[model samples]
Target chain A: MKRRDFITATALAAAFGLAGKPVYNVLASKDALASKTGKRLAMVIDLKKFEGNSEMMNKCVDACHSMHNVPDIEGAKEEVKWIWPEPFEHAFLEQNNQFIPENIQNNPILIMCNHCDNPPCVGVCPPKATWKRAEDGVVMMDWHRCIGCRYCMAACPYGSRSFNWRDPRPKIKNITANFPTRSKGVVEKCTFCDERIVKGLEPACVVASKMYEPEAMVFGDLNDDKSNIRKILSENYSIRRKPELSTQPEVYYLI
Target chain B: MLDKIFTGGKKYWAWMIFLSSIIGAGTLAYLHQYEVGLGVTGMGRDVTWAFYISQLTFFVGVAASAVMVVLPYYLHDYKKFGKITILGEFLAIGAVIMCMTFVFVDMGQPLRVVNMFLHPQLTSPMFWDSVSLMGYLVLNIVISRVVLNAERNGVKPPKWIKPVIYTSIPWAVSIHTVTAFLYCGLAARPFWMSAIMAPRFLATAFAAGPALLIIICFVLRKVSKFDVGKDAIQKLAVIAAYAMFANIFFLALEFFTAYYSGMHHHTQHFQLLYVGLEGNSSLVPWMWTSTVLAAISLYILINPNTRKNEKILGFGAIAVFLSIWMDKGMGLIIAGLVPNPLGYVVDYTPTLIELTISAGIFALGALIISALYKSVLTIRRQV
Candidate 1:
């Protein structure tokens, strides 16, 4: 070892030793903090952008479904969805205000798993089959581990999760090669484009929404103060579904 | 004892054959469900849990109701209840079997049930529900077997058996409470979130369980000369009356809190249960019939003059059982889901396959009860 480098390292170790802390303690603390403050991804939906724009909404829906291989079942009872639109008033029933404009009240606002910091789905899962990821705040489902008990469905106040009522493979016209399709007898939901995110690509719906002049959605790590989602969330007046339940929903809807 | 179950009268054999046929059909339907998924059932995306879960809730109550007899006989040292307590224990065994079967059939992946135990989590109500149920089942089995054997020999039960019997009394209460916890813990379901859920479950369980036993006892006396005695029947009637009253009072409280608070989450559930919500009221008639029947049963039970007459008493008992069956068996599970999380009304109607599967499970329990009673009578007579 070089004499100068060896002496400097020894000196730093001695300083830490004198302070009754190990030299690795500093590195360990940084790593521990980093894990504790991992990325919390969130989505911001601009409701105004979807007003009377059924064609644009359909495009966004198609992109997400085709990419995810979500089946297009015939009836509402057997329907499966990763992301879908809901009526504005129905989406936020707790805010039973009478004065929402007629057009806005009836307009369909996109809804999916809020991916809450304190998710009820994760809390109710008996086998730990469904859990909120520590690194990304995505409510993940392990289909193999799941017993398809549907307790997660009951626990979700937003109706975000869907159970595979039948085999979904036959109904999928085109399968997304990168993403794995789910089997029957399992519960599933929006995984926040987990595969795409790892590849350093934005969610499909977010990319699709950019085709129009006014972008309808923004997706980013909520932990990043400099990210566009955080900035948009702070600047605009927004609402979340069933916030009184104290799930601390990450998804924001700008009306 | 082994031959006793097989060596029944022609009518008994005919009844067994009838149940066996239904169970056979249900087994076929279940196979279809297993090959396909829960899609064949009437349950859907919105009302996810329906008939099977409702039956589980009802049978769990029936399983726990055995304690009503056990507590009075063992704790109070009431001698009249000694003979009837065995019937209660046997009924518990039957009910618990039904409970387990309902759960198994309801499961989307029944094969993965072992995972529940292998990865047991104390925090999960479903885990504790299984724990309490299995625990109660084993307790009842051990207690009933040991005590019945001692009775057969015309001797005192072992000292250890006393503690086990005592444990079962509270264990009975725990099974129903844990079952209620399965529903009440879900913060997303406002209808089941009240603290009164456990008490209401217990009250209904006590009423329904003993009411069923009364009917069973009447049948056993006529057919098998196995009378649990006139005084025992009267005592059970009184117990059921009080429980039914408590059950009614709790229902009233549920109504008052939900309607008076004016919370849509709370009121909307009751609206679905009692009246039509948004003109889609499939369960309205059933819920009203149950309520009216309960009130009528309460009247008959409360009147000592009517309660003493065997025919009148039988009618009251049957009414109470049916009333509670409707309440827990249909209303409890369905009402929670009607105005679903999105505040949209979606009704769940059990399909023929679902109904058949449920009937099969019910029949299986009755068969177990019949066999166990036959064995009990034979062994006791022989000894």
Candidate 2:
């Protein structure tokens, strides 16, 4: 019944150009569900397949960038970066403590914003332009409210937040044609493909998970014992990067 | 102020024209940036912030330095600072304006500065930074106005302004503390996350601020016929010498930890400055030159005989100020951002547009100081 009401409200709001009111409508309903079920969203990535699947990483990047309307400029100082993969050695440099296997040496690790449990960027933002949603734990940026100070970019440990140095809307191609182009002078980061997750679909990258090894991808409710992620966590020797930093990053890796 | 301005004759107009031209050029450069966006600046993704922020940091230190003079003069009734405290206050006012302007240009959307308050985040250091900066600005303006009013009327200020003045003493310290936290609080940037950051900032602020005061006092004596007194100059130099000692000491401690512990991520930035990480060493020469100049300047400042000698004192003041400016403003921010957290190398060089706008902001500060000095001289009659 609640789902039926959401569909009706969403259809009406879109028809009447009450676009801004829909987020509140969805959030209010989510809060109601949370009070009863107490569920939280999370992901667990298998390192085995993700270590070498460049094709999978690229596919996911394309899908994420297209959906978010991120721009590609090689020379702009304040480039807008939504998602990108980094070499494994660089991504987990601190955690590479002499025990890792040689087969995975220098392989790429698909990374976006970690969506930390204790997000430093959220804590340091003076205007609360950046926030972690209590419902799904996706760290989000409100570009309209961001003052272009780039403080969040500085505070982010992963350098996930990208600043818009130039108008990014025009640069996006037809592949990313439908994405919302950000204006010049605001900070942006990965939202774990919230637009898709909201539609009862997996993240864009998760949907493209088949391009990589089956061991390379996992996403589910961390709070549910019946969830696949919980089963994997209880069985495998899973690890998160820079555990010493205590950021409690939601993304986990099984090496 | 208008009457005195007209009284300065041909020499004053000539000086005003010279200062105005520099400021005019700077303003033109600033407008160009506004039209084209921040793309005109040399900053890039890796070194996202460049000269403007460095200059802003240096000017903030300069603005905070006025507290040293103010505390001694007002709270302790140190008559030695009587002839000079007003100059410090006015210099601070100018520095604050420049600091604010530099920050403005560095912003991607200067118009959005209002967004800071409409949706402020208490958790972000930047939120605190904005609050502290605004608080200090209001405090400096109010104190300067009240103190000048008392000075003009030939009477002490009303009792109400005293508590505010005293409050600013601690508030002055807080400005630099918050600025340092802007860097040190970042968990990923290891080079910046040191606990010594706030203390180091205070030390450098004291060191560089007094050195600048020494030079300004000399310039005033030559150009405006202001008597800052040899005794006060010597005393301030001693203060600068101690501050420099503390600054260097803190730096040395940082070095010991980075090198001794030998954490690869931690040592990479330190190596970038002194020896160049990954064979890129452009900053190496600048860093070494700054260190050498600072050490020599400290030696000169520490010696009573050398400090009292106007020529040596002048050199020492300029050297110390420049060294601290390079170390804190340029090296600190850039080095912290290096070896991008992703373990990639990112280098930055300021472009012509960035340099011009920066120069213009500095010139703007000097222009205000020159005009204010002329007005105050006319009113005070050379103290």
Candidate 3:
């Protein structure tokens, strides 16, 4: 091609690249828009429902893991857990009673990020990589901002946060093209399924659990008393993990 | 200044080579760690920090201990410490540099350490720790240089050095207090959540820091034409004795409160250290050994007869040094993390690579200290 023609072609490419996507386009692709007024996202898990339905629980775990591309490494030493089972006694040790029923004590219950009103994890972070969203109560992690210091993991009382010890990409069983894979060293956990919640969809785990057992998982806005989670929590008395710490955990477990 | 370090005897060269080889090995280990990830170390999701942080904590005390000598000599005009004040300040310089290195090496994304400055979080004690430590480092470097230069030229130090020297006293205290705050403020770990952690840190620091100086002065006495003075050594021993008393007393208070109150969470950490929680007593042997060694050192230090015997005092000083190292570096650090947030006895033993990297950091600090000390010694000789 002639030099003049080549110049024109390069100029055309630069103009397209520079003006291609506006700020709105980038924000549109991001997770969770400002939550609706008077709506605070919360979840209620029925402890009774998980009994002898371990496979169903595994499915819920897999759905969230697969959805988020959480690593599938073996061994508890370097496990990167998002959502998993914890024995009732260990999960609520502060509230444990000797006279409590054996079934509740022996059985394991599903647990994840509480998305506390006052997140201690956010408080300790030297960089504000993890923060509580203003619109909703969900504690969110900005992957780009994280220095992978793991102070957040230490500050989290419930052991919700997980660090990418090694390159998580290799261990991720199903390379889900839909989600971004995390680099090694960054902290990650349940973002309260912010991406899906913003899209007006329930979390992957909730959707997966509903398929096998609808009564097992409930997720909705806690501010709306009529919402499914609020309704369930209101009817059946529920307990939160380490409530005395005043983290004001949004995740509740219904007996 | 550089020529003095280069013009060393056979022993000095051997020492440099030994430190260098360890540093070289450590650098290789760090390279491998940087290539892979922190997973190469024993650190996991449960015990997120272990060896690196513990080393940083130990050295922060080492760095802060400089103020003990600095404050006495500079602020209070304790002239006995005049001969050794530069020694303490120079040691702080080397220690702060190592502290910074350990923090850097511990990072998952070490390259992103600049983020601490770029987007600083004022609420984080870690931010203040970095600030105070770096500030104290500069304070020492300036004060030591001014004094050493003034001495070499047969003149008084600049007028400005007095206030800067004064600032270093509290600045030194702040660095360790901020480091203590790093653990104490963590509401999650019951072991480190006490108000006394900062005091505990200071107490242990005072004992360990001067105990180390006692040994270093002895080494200096033998090696060079210069002597740090017998009076300075004895005075530091007295300071160390009082400090160790406070350290042991503070530890006893921790035990008393935990056992007497019978708070399950509080007692659990002690159980983990002493008896081993849930059949995992890996730290039991180490803690008991440290306790025994500490007792022996205290006995030697507190007694009037043994304190007068420099040979016995040297032995006690070494004991105190190792005792504090075990307590600060191993026992205290891992104890808070073992019974992790979820009641898991997740043990953390630094991998070979981690050990090498840590050794490398120690060697690096020794190299810096030795080089700086050599320059100072030469400068003193010329005067």
Candidate 4:
């Protein structure tokens, strides 16, 4: 073709391409829009509902572990846990009291990854294997990329992360086909059920807790003021693990 | 030059054989660790870093301590240190190699370590540490090779090597400081989150590094009739003495801050190391042993008459070397992880496989130093 005719044709094509970009974006799905302007997901655990209730706590723990294929190793040193329970005193070290009632003091408090707004683990990772997702504020681990240096484990103040010291495949009692089981020599942790949330479903632990006691575990977007987590957090006196460190944990405990 | 390693005497061959055996054993243990995973070691979910990382920390100091000699000779034109500056540089090369090896062994996925360079995170102190250590290693190797070759040929070194030698001085300091930042920047572990960590590391490094050099000098003189001169030994002793003093003083400052402030988080680690926390006193004996050795070393090093005696000076050097090794290598890293994040005390003791692997790395360092020193002696004899 002649040079002038080619130039005119290119201009027409460029104009159409520019015009088509906005049209394509405008027709994008709702999920894509939600991801672009993401919500700050948070969780609220009602201490009154879970306190001294080991069965309910275990149910939540089992639901998370079974769904995620967390290894049920025998020893404490090599054990892998997604969600577990700690005594009230241990959970709230800053608020420990000598005069508190024994039952309340020894009560089991459900604990998992705080999914902090500013995660030190994400910062210390040499390979950027662990990072805080900008969309939902959930700290994530890329098992394939982790070199298993354990710097993230050391940096996590809440002990939320677990290392697969051995091949975890053999230890997983009932493997879930939906979620992937991590290999040995990688750090794994609670993902805030990113997979479930993306499917418009609540976290496994939250759904499990709701079966026994409604609203015992609440999960929602903290940015949405109308969400149950925001409403509960504002109405109740809540505390977080090691707030003085200023990790700004998203998980709150309503006492 | 590489052929000199194979041209050693009977005693040299025997020593090499011994080191090779240990290396062989260590290699076997490491293979097992690789097969079975890190679970074969004592490291747990709570105490993720222990013997391997601690040794890495200790050896980084040794590598950096080459600056103690390099700065005095090249900067101040100190004639006494001229004879031994090559020795110090070669020692740094060996220590840096060991540092890299320890890091490699501690990794859960040793093969994937290339990802560190592939997807480098500038924010991580570990990334900076790897960069500084590799740079320092290359600097020492180039300086030592060029300068020593010049000496063997009866000529001055090339002009470009002077700036490279000078760059090594600050570069040495950066390696240790960056290693310290690896631990100190972690807000989670309050035990390592101290401002004085870098200074304390430098102080102990200057002491331990020269102390080991003094012992090596004595051994070289007796075995190979290689006299590095009395003045060099005395000067090194004095440097070691002052560095030990600074180390103790810095440690005292740590004690005061931990105890006087009366904060549980700050004091708990000290309590665990010194006095045994909650009836778990696994580390108390080792800490006290280090303390006693440090005290004895200081007492002998400070007295002029005792420091003047060659026989006693060797003992003092050994004392200081062992003391700092125990403190930095065995105590510091483990104590920081005890009484883990959630107020649970889970003590860690290195498994046999772990110890074997560490022993192999130490033997490798010794083997490198032995081979390099042998070459130096052979070249000097020809001159």
Better of 2 and 4 by DockQ: 4
Q: Give the lowest summed-lDDT range of ten residues in model 1 chain A.
A: A27-36
Q: A1-255, model 2: which lDDT tens digit per residue?
A: 699999999899787776657867867752112221455677777767765567887887887777777787776356667667766677787776676667567667777788887788888876788888887777887888777777777777787788877677667775454456678877788887777778888787787776555646777777788988889989998777665676778788776
Write the residue-wise lDDT of candidate 3 on B1-383 in tens digits: 55677876788889889999999999999999988999999998888889999999999999999988988887788999988888898899999999999998888887777777788777778878888888988888888888888987899988988888888888888999999999998878899899999999999999999999999998888888767777888899999999999999999999999999999899998998889889888888888989998999999999989988999999999999898888899888788876887777777778999999999999999999998898888877721
lDDT of 1 by residue, A1-255 (tens): 999999999999988788766546655653111233889888899988888888788888899999999999998798999889888777888885889788788888888888887787886777878887888887787888888888889889899888898899999999988878888888988888888888889888888888873558888887788988888988989988887787878789888
Residue A222 lDDT, candidate 4, scale 0-100: 83
How well docked is model 2, in DockQ terms?
0.44
lDDT (Cα atoms) of all candidates against the true structure = 0.87, 0.81, 0.87, 0.91
Best by DockQ: 4
Q: Per-residue lDDT tens digits of candidate 4, residues A1-255?
A: 999999999999999999999889869733211232578888999988986688999999999999999989997899899899988777787688889887678778989999987788988899999988888878888999999999998888899999999899999999999899898899999999999888999999999999889999999998887887888888889888988887888889887
Q: Give lDDT tens digits, candidate 1, residues B293-321.
A: 99889999999999999899999999999
Q: Write the per-residue lDDT of candidate 3 for residues A64-140, one digit (tens) a residue.
A: 99989998889987899899988887788787788998888878888999998778888777777888888777899
DockQ of each model vs. true complex: 0.50, 0.44, 0.48, 0.61
Q: Which lDDT tens digits does candidate 4 get at residues B127-171? A: 999999999999999999999889888999999999999899999
Q: For model 4, what fraction of the real interface contacts is kept?
A: 0.78
Residue A241 in model 4: shift from native, Å? 0.5
Clash pairs for candidate 1: none
Off by over 4 Å in 1: A1-36, A213-215, B1-3
Q: After superposition, which runs of candidate 3 have C-alpha atoms over 4 Å from their true positions?
A: A1-38
Q: Fnat of each prediction? A: 0.65, 0.72, 0.62, 0.78
Best by TM-score: 4
- Candidate 4, position A8, lDDT: 100
